[model samples]
Target: MSARDGLDADERHLLVVDDDDRIRDLLKKYLSRAGFRVTAAADAGQARKLMSMLDFDLMILDVMMPGEDGFSLTKSIRARPGRQTPVLILTARGLPDDRIEGLALGADDYLAKPFEPQELLLRVEAILRRAGPRPVVQRRLSLGPCTFDVERGELSRDGKPVRITEAEAQLLRTLAKAAHAPVDRLALAPDATDATGRAVDVQVTRLRRKIEADPKNPRYLQTVRGVGYMLAPDE
Candidate 1:
């Protein structure tokens, strides 16, 4: 039986960042065969650029790159505001301290060089499994006095229809879909050409005004520090 027998390879995308072209290509080919869409970056700079534009299910990073090593890259990634994509550190440094540091820096797993391809595939699968599936968005969400119907992208306050722009409705639906989980600002403004997430911030502010009793201190549309915004619905 094939390792990827029942897996949906087309859905999960992986980013492989390594300085060595040979190892990077080999890993990409092997993982692709194992049922995953793969993209490769030669260094942290390239990896960062790719991350800004595309979302990846997981990252395979080499720890010994020339500029901004894997450890540093991992730290920066964790510190940044947005999705905390799972990372697996692949490196020649197999020492105890190295592994400890990688985990401490928020890496999902650590694998030393001279490792078997089968072992690597297993580790990748394990990490993806641990990350779990995406949260299922409820059709209806309660935000204090305001209730949102995700299916219709409609918001009502105290059983009365609330006036909202199409843009606001779209934003609210996006937030409601993630309900309680932080939705990346970029993800919120999928149509906006602006990459700074300013458009998302504006939309959130507008949505909060309608749904929050105190827009100054939002209760439902809450900001996630160093991440994005989360929709905390009333139970």
Candidate 2:
């Protein structure tokens, strides 16, 4: 599968967790044709089992299930120490509040039940683009209570996302590349050619608020005095 929208389709593995056999099969077929490797589970139990053995690029979880509901499952997954898997929730009860709750619970996107296959594909592709790439490398980095999945540009604390802005993610990506070493402020910008030192510092302070227990005295992301900043991987 060729890469689409910066997504390496050949390496994209999606987990479809739905108790409805008809919907699950239909989604699996549709998404597979769209060049994603789809794995379907009948319930959260089976989904959790598959998750343990595989690293999925994204998960499509249903809101209502027999034992463990999608909300609870998403919460549980987000609560894990290192897993920052993106989740897209599906539900028949597509109230405004429901969508808000799902988003608040750390879901990347949500789809109301009875959505068209094409719509689903569109949303999936959009989310994948927003989620970014899975670069082929030793890409996982620990930052205290949080872990950064370098390729995915995801930073999470105990599996819950820290919600860094795009620029901040770009900065972290640069810092993560040279963990234990200082990265120049200009080099931390999304575009080093146009970024100002003050802009970089502002972003660093924002990131520290999320990653550091005390932003005043940072532990993980540290200023290197005159050299710029360093991300110490010790914590």
Best by the TM-score measure? 1
Question: What residue pairs clash in candidate 1, if any at all?
Answer: none
TM value for model 2: 0.57
**Pairs that collide, model 2:** none
How many steric overlaps are in each model, in order? Answer: 0, 0
lDDT of 1 by residue, 173-223 (tens): 666655678877776764468999998888888888898999999989999
TM-scores of the models, in the order given: 0.60, 0.57
lDDT (C-alpha) at residue 39 in model 2: 95
